[model samples]
Target chain A: MPGWLLTVWAAVVAMVVVFTFLTIMVMFSVWMERKVAGFIQHRVGPMRAGGFHGWAQSIADSIKLLFKEDLILIGADRKLFQIAPALVMATATAMFVVLPFAPGWQVADADLGVFLILALASVTTIGVIMAGWGSYNKWSVYGAMREAAQVASYEIPLALSLIPPILHYGTFSLATATEAQAGWGGMQWYVFSSAAPVAWLSFPLFFIAALAENKRAPFDLPEAESELVAGFHTEYTGIRFSFFFLEEYAAMFVMGAVGAALWFGGWNFPGIHLLEPGSALLQVLALFAFVAKAMALVFVMMWVRWTVPRLRIDQVMTLGYKYLTPLSMAVVLIAAFWEFGLHLIQD
Target chain B: MALPTPPREPARRHHYLGDILSTIHSTAKGMALTMRYLWRKPVTMDYPKEKPVIDQRYRGIHVLDQQLCIYCDLCAKACPVDCIEMDAVRHGKEIEWKAFTLDYQKCMFCELCVYPCPKDCFIQGTEYSMVSEDRNDFVHDLLTWKGLREEEPS
Candidate 1:
C-alpha cells in the first residue's frame, strides 16, 4: 500500500477497534450500574435473561431500543434536533484518535494531541445544548443551558489540572508524556515525582473535573431525570438516543485513558522492559496491562457514579470554582516554589 | 432533586501546576481500592449454567392441597380479588361437601386465602414460571385432592 493509503487503513482499523471496545465497555457499564444499584437497594439485578447474572440484559435492551419509534419534537427545529446526537457521537469518538493505548498504538499522534482531545470533548456540550435548544421545549432549554454552564465552568479546572503535567513533561504530546514515565519502578510515575508537586494535585482536580466532563453523578445536572425528565435529549428516541448513550461511554473511556497517561504512566510498569531489545512478548503483555489500567479507572468512575448522589447544578459549579480550583492553584504554587528552591540550592 | 442557585462568588482559577498534583493523589487512592477488588474473587455467578440457592421463605407459585380443605367460605371471602371460587354438595347423610376452584388470573399471590383456610390445605409451590395461552388454563380445581387423601389413608 502507498504510505497515505497505509495511514488511512491504520486509522480505519484503530477507529473500528476503539468503537467496538467502547460498545462493549458501555454494555458492561450498564450491567455494572444495575448490579451496583441492586446491591445498594438490597435487590438482585437482572438475574434471569440469558442467565449467568443477566449478562445479556444490555444486549436485549439495545435491541429493544433499536426497534422503538424514533420521535422528533413536532415544534422543534427539525434539522438541528435530528443532527445533534450525531454531532455528540462524532465528537466523542473523534477524541480517541489521539489516545495512545500503548507505544505506536495510537490512531493519530497529532502534535496538538492534548489540545485536540480537550477541544473535541467540549464539542459534546455544544451538541447537548443544540439538542436542548432545538427541541423548543422549556425543560430541554433549561437542561442545555445548565449543561453548557456546568461543563464550561468545569473545563477550567480540568484544563488547569493538565497543565502541571504538560509543564513537567515539556510537551503537548500524550505519547511523549507516557514515554517519559517508562521505567522499572512505580516511584518514577509523574504523580510521584519530586520535580512536580503540582502533578499530584492535578490527579484529583482532573478526576472531579472529568466526572463533570462525562456528566457522571454529582455533576449530572444536565440529565437530572427527576427534575428535567430526561434532560436535553428528552425528545430523542430510538437510535438517536443510542447515539447519546454511546457518546457518554466513549467519553468515559477517553477520560480514563487520559487520566492513565497523565498520572499512572501510560503503558509503563515497574520492572517491565518489553520495549527493550528482544522482549516482544513482554511488550505485548505490557500493552494489555496498559488497557487493563485504563479499564480499571473506568470501573472506578462507575463506582463513584453509583456511590454519590447527583449534585445540583449550582453546587456542581461551586465544587469546580470555589473548592477544586483554589486547591489546584495552591498545589501549583507550592510545586513551583519547591522546584525553584531545589534549583537554587543545587546551584 | 432541586437545582441549587449558582454561587455569588467569582469562579476560582487554580494554578495550572496544582491541578495535576491533586489528580495524582486522588488516582492513587482510587487505584488502591481497585487493586483490592481485583484480587478478591468476583461475586458474579453465571446465570443459566449455575443455579443459586434460594431462601426457603421465597414466595413462588401457589399450589392448593384439596383433601385437607373444608368446604368453608372463609378462604373465598378472605380473597381480596375474589379469584378463588369453591363449590360443594351435601354428601351421604353426614352433609359433607367437596369441590373447589381457584383462578390464578385474579390471584395476587398474597397468600391471604391460604392462611384463612380451615382445612390447612392451601400451599405455595416453588414453580414460578407458570405461563398459559388460554386464560381458562389458569383456573385450577381441587377435586382430586380428596381422592388422593383417601388413597393415602390419612
Candidate 2:
C-alpha cells in the first residue's frame, strides 16, 4: 500500500477504536455515576436493567432516549436546533483525536496537542449556546446564557493551569510531556513532583477548572435540573437529546485523559520504562496505567458531584473570577520561576 | 438583671482566612463522611427479590375461617362504607353460607370487619401486595379465603 493510503487507513482505524472506547467509557461512567449517587443517597440505583447492579442501565437509557418523540417547539429555529447536538458531539469527538491514550495509540500526534484540545473543548460551549437560542424557550435561553458565561470564565483558569505542565517540560506536545516525566518510576508524576509547590498545586487547580468547564455539579448551573427544566436541550428529544448526553460523558472522559496525560504520567507505570516500548507487555501495562489514572479522575468527578451541592450562578462566577483565575495565574508565574531558579542553580 | 441590649448592629465579623480554612475543612469532612458511606453497604433492600418483614398487627387483606363463621350479619353491618355483603340460606337448624363478598374499592382495611365478627372467623393477614388489572379483582370473596392458609384457621 502507498504511504498516504496507509496513513489514511491508520487514521480510520484510530477513529473506530477511539469512538468505541469513548462509547463504552461514556456508558460505564453514566452507570457508575448513578450507582455512586445512589450509594451516597443510601438508595439502590438501577438493579434490574442488566440484572447485576443495572450494568446495562445506560444502554437501556440510551435506547429509551433514542425512541422518544422528537419534539420541536413552535417558533424554534429548526436548523440550528437540529445541528446543535451534532456540533457538540463533533467537538467532543475531535478532542479524543489529540488525546494520547497510550504510546502510539493516539489518532494524531499533533505538536500543538494541548492547544488543539483546549480549542476544540471550548467549541462545545458554542453548540450549547446554539441549542439554547434555537429552542426559543426562556428557560433554555437562561441555561444557555449561564452555560456560555460559566465555560467562558472557567476557560481562563483551565487554560492557565495547563501551562504549568508544559512549562515543566518546555513542550506543547503531550507525548513529549508524558515522556519527559518518565525515569523515577511513578515518583516523577507531576502532581507528586516537588519540583515546586506549584507543581503539586497545579493538579487540583486544573481539576477544579476542568470540572467547571465540563459543567459538572457545583459548577453545573447550566443544567440545574431543579431550576431549569432540561436546560439548553429542553426542546430536544429522541436521538438529539442522547447526543447531548453522549457529548457530556465523552467530554468528561476527554478531560480525564487530558488530566492523566499532563499530570498523572499517561500510561507510564513504576518500572514500566524498563520494558521495551515495542513489547506487547509494556504496551498493555502502559494502556492500563493511562486508563487507570483517567478512570480515577473520572471517579473523583463523580464523587465530588454527589458530595458537593450545586453552586449558585453568582458563586460559580465568584469562584472562577475571584479565586481560581488569580490562583492559576500565580501558579503559572510560580512554575516559571521554579523552572528558572532550577536552571540557575544547575548552571 | 437588665434585659441584655440587642447588639447595636449584630457583631460585624469577617474572617477571610478563617472562612477559607473552614470551607476546606467542612468540605473535606463532608467528602470523608460520604466516602465512608460509599464504601459501606447500601441501605437499600433489593425490594423485588426479598419480602419485607410485616408487623403482626398490621391490617392487610381479609382472611376468613369459613368453618367457624356463623353466617352472622355483624361484619356487614359494622362496615362504615357498607362495602361488605353477606348472604346465607337458612335450612332448618343449619345456616348454609352462600356469598360473602367484600368490595375492597370502599373497604378501608380498618380491621373493623375483624372485630365485629361474632364467630371470630374473620381476621386480617399481613400481606399487602395485591395487584390486578381488572376492576372486578378489587372485590374479594371471603369464602374463597383470600390471603390465607387452609391449614391455619383464625
* Residue runs of model 1 more than 4 Å from their true location after superposition: A1-7, A36-46, A184-187, A274-279, A335-347, B1-99, B104-133, B145-154
lDDT (Cα, tens digit) per residue for candidate 2, span A147-207:
9878867899999999988988888888888887776865477776646477677878899
**Candidate 2 ranges beyond 4 A from true positions:** A1-8, A194-196, B1-17, B145-154
lDDT of 1 by residue, B1-154 (tens): 9999987898788765576568557756755664454455546665556777876665566666554555667988998999877766555433234557778888888888777777776766666666889988888765554322334435
Best-fitting candidate, scored by DockQ = 2
Candidate 1's C-alpha lDDT? 0.78
Q: In angstroms, how far off is A143's CA in candidate 2?
A: 0.5
DockQ of each: 0.12, 0.58
Across A1-347, the per-residue lDDT of candidate 1 in tens digits comes to 89999989987888899788778878887887777656544556787768788899999989988999988767999989988999999999898878877678787888778899889989999999999999988889988999988976788888887777777677888888888887645336787765645676678788888889998876888988989998898888899999998898889878988888878888777766524633676567667867777777787787777556787877777778777778767666766676677679879
Q: What is the lDDT of residue B116 in candidate 2?
A: 75
